[model samples]
Target: MILRFSQLIVGLILFGAGCAVMVDAGIGLDPWTVLAEGISKNTGIGIGWVVSITGFLVLLLWIPLRQKPGVGTVANILVVGAAMQFTLPLVSTPDHWIARVAMFIAGTALVGVASGIYIGARLGPGPRDGLMTGIHQRWGWPIWAGRLGVEATVLVTGWLLGGTVGLGTVLFAVLIGPMVHVSLPVFDGRARRRRHTTPAAAVGGLSAPGT
Candidate 1:
């Protein structure tokens, strides 16, 4: 059930692409996006760089967890930040409420796609995702609890640094798991399906596949 490097790359790309679309929509972004917004404000190296930097830091959290930092780990380190920078300008929304809202919905869906792809790969773990897993193990908390704690910590830090936080952020917390859960199965290839047919699969309803 170990992930190959190709699967890892696909997952990272999905994760990264989702982030780009979500932000581009500008309705709101996921909790991690909120964190990135904060970093971008303080660093002023652009939002993209902040995302990359944060991803790198989060990935580091995995090493201490006894998780093997594989090609997927390396791919995550490079892809998200790079993908953010590369894709942001290419895809954007118009300056209207309707367009923005539609974009936001699309963005949320993209996040699901990204989550499904990356989590499906069952590669090591994205830095952000790794943070949640690390906290869960250390505190013996549920995935939701760990995720909320990790996200709240990041969101507050991001807010202190002036990252975007609003209804969109709230929406991400409330809805992202279902979206990811539903999408992964739809997008998964036959190989992935065979790999996923068994477990109950409900860590906040979005447990990473093959994990």
Candidate 2:
């Protein structure tokens, strides 16, 4: 449990730092970050504050979906934005395009790795992830379809609101899914262990309560 908690904290911090790095790269942002940036632009609030607020708002949505948040979920709301705020000032954009591209790539990779680390803890999904999975569970939609629908809506809305949508955004869209796919198995041993140890849940499979 201690190790899982430690992994969750480290993953959230790294995730935030990765976001800061991508923002500093000045290329583009993930769909959700783009929405946060757009909201920040419109409201004259800091992006980190917008992110934290957006998370809380998303959590509210979970109430109706009957999704339960664990310690990781609440920690995700607080720690990620705070870490981003702390890291942004410490990181700077490079003048060279090559360096900026490198930063963007590194940031995207870090996000994937961090996601695997945190999700592997199996405490709970992050707010955005819960939204996607909740939609899947409630509507019988495929997880991919749910994710796509949510991301497309956010991307279009963010773009309309004057968020950056550039090569980096395209790169993230193309790469992040595959990155997480590869990373998850490497890090999700804990979840597999839990499933194996809890044979009844495994036997019932996807239809099981608390599955």
lDDT of 2 by residue, 63-113 (tens): 878899999999999989888888889999999999999999999999889
Question: Measured by TM-score, how close is model 2 to the native structure?
Answer: 0.87
- Give the 10-residue window scoring lowest on summed lDDT in candidate 2: 202-211
Off by over 4 Å in 2: 191-211
TM-score to native of every candidate shown: 0.79, 0.87
- Report lDDT per candidate: 0.71, 0.87
lDDT of 2 at 86: 89
Error of 1 at 151 (Å): 0.6
* Candidate No. with top lDDT: 2
Which 10 residues in a row give candidate 1 its minimum summed lDDT?
202-211
- Candidate 1: residue 59 lDDT (0-100): 72
Candidate 1 lDDT, 144-180, residue by residue in tens: 8887777778778777777777767777777787987
